[model samples]
Target: MSAQLPKIFITGATGLVGSALVTELLAKGHHLRALVRTSSAQLPGSVEQVVGELGQPVDLSDSQVVIHAAARVHVMQETTSDPLVEFRAVNVDATLALARQAIAAGVRRFVYISSIKVNGEGTEQGKPFKTNDVPAPADPYGISKMEAEQGLMALAKESDMEVVIIRPVLVYGPGVKANFRSMMNWLNKGIPLPLGRIDNKRSLVALDNLVDLIVTCAQHPAAANQTFLVSDGEDLSTTELLTRMSKALDRPARLLPVPAGLLELSGKLLGKDAVMQRLCGSLQVDISHTRDTLGWVPPVSVDSALRKTADHFLSTL
Candidate 1:
């Protein structure tokens, strides 16, 4: 007999990840209940909409799987005086609340979308982050996710609901925001960058690949009670990424091979060390566990995904 399509409840349905997730699942004939803040967002007619934030109660009693993609993502120069407190309200406290409710609703699986930052800031060239590594969250965002993971684990121990955590590295695709979009804009606009000399390996995941894994986990028996890290499984240096982006944009990559040390110093003096560190550092993930355990591979190649991202970027402008 063929496998049955599960009824999935999703949060953050308007954001990039959630939106794409909705589309992917529906394309495979799964029933989706998307929780959004507005009804005006463009979505297929078949998708059931629960218009509200995570605070309000939506019926998940019949949902086979609950995919929590909503969170307090990292914001640059947040104006809130108590950013941590504000972040906790969403990432930590709100997450646990929803998880507890899902458990009460008898949801079969709760897949929490976590960040790779829970592992650490970055990795050395040869030392990629593994799923078993002790969490060393550096920023407020990472710390909150780590706390949420702990809370969910404790809750899972007391309930029949299976909790699966997936910590994905930087996710990029059409309509990407923040840092990835910034890089796309810079390269698309023909801005000369100083990251040519940096020798680093960073792991990034395409949206399609991440969504594929999430769907696999939604039904895979082995994925239950497992915490895994996911990526494109292809690491690229800053220069290489820029070159690829330029190729996608059909533009010349005018790279200045300035010393990485000098660039970092300038960033520090200008209060942008975090930005420089991301460009000049290595952050790789070891996805062997996920691949071996699930018998899965990234569905999209890096080149094709990047090209699609660039095309979408150009269309947006």
Candidate 2:
């Protein structure tokens, strides 16, 4: 890195991934401008805030880097009649618009934060999804992400701007919400869960580790025009995850020894089959390419990250 780091313009400043990213970049002496739809938190007064939504165009002339972390993320229960159309408007159309604007502003690089679902829902045991494999997006949200990647690649081919795409699996850390947070809450409350018997391997990226990768790709010459799968490089089964989480929370894991098959059956009966699959599914990523190609290693250990997340969750109570 140069003594004079490049200015970075990032979207999703309030999100789980983006806020931490802003902090990391700032700590390394980089000036940052963040897009804030609402009053985004965790930023110091020195950082500039660009009040806007994803669909609007922004001035990226002074920025050498653009991190497009904002997107219409996956909705479990989509209310729209045509969800794909809604997803494309922001994820595909608006994202492409932003990339073109960045290119026009002579921004050197664009870092797109994509989802692992673009590679597919889950993989069979011992078979992890690689960045080189063909995409098999299983849902509207994943499909939209693939489309955005394709469009960005096309745009990059016709312009001087470099594009780096990152597809990450479940990202968990302090202040995480949704499923991972719910799991921590359940464990903290000693609520018994029927996931003790399920053996599933899932790759998770710590928030700090992912921020490191984002900053790495922001300027790394080797990372130009590359797509990578990111993880902590440590895979854990459902049972193991619960156990470690319990240890971090200083609570007992009240997981029952229920058969995976029986859990799946009950999930279908209760309209939670998808949730069950997520909790007991195998969704691992092979990050050897990331390590060999980018010379990047996750900066945070999974156990330590989990402990930090547990500490935060406990603090909220």
Q: Compared with the true structure, what per-residue lDDT tens digits does model 1 show for residues 55-126?
A: 566678779899999999888879998888888899999899889889889998999999998998999998
Residue-by-residue lDDT tens digits, candidate 2, 245-270:
99999999899999999989999999
TM per prediction: 0.96, 0.97
Poorly placed runs, candidate 2 (over 4 Å) = 1-3, 38-42
TM-score attained by model 1: 0.96
* CA lDDT of every candidate: 0.90, 0.91
RMSD of each: 1.4, 1.3
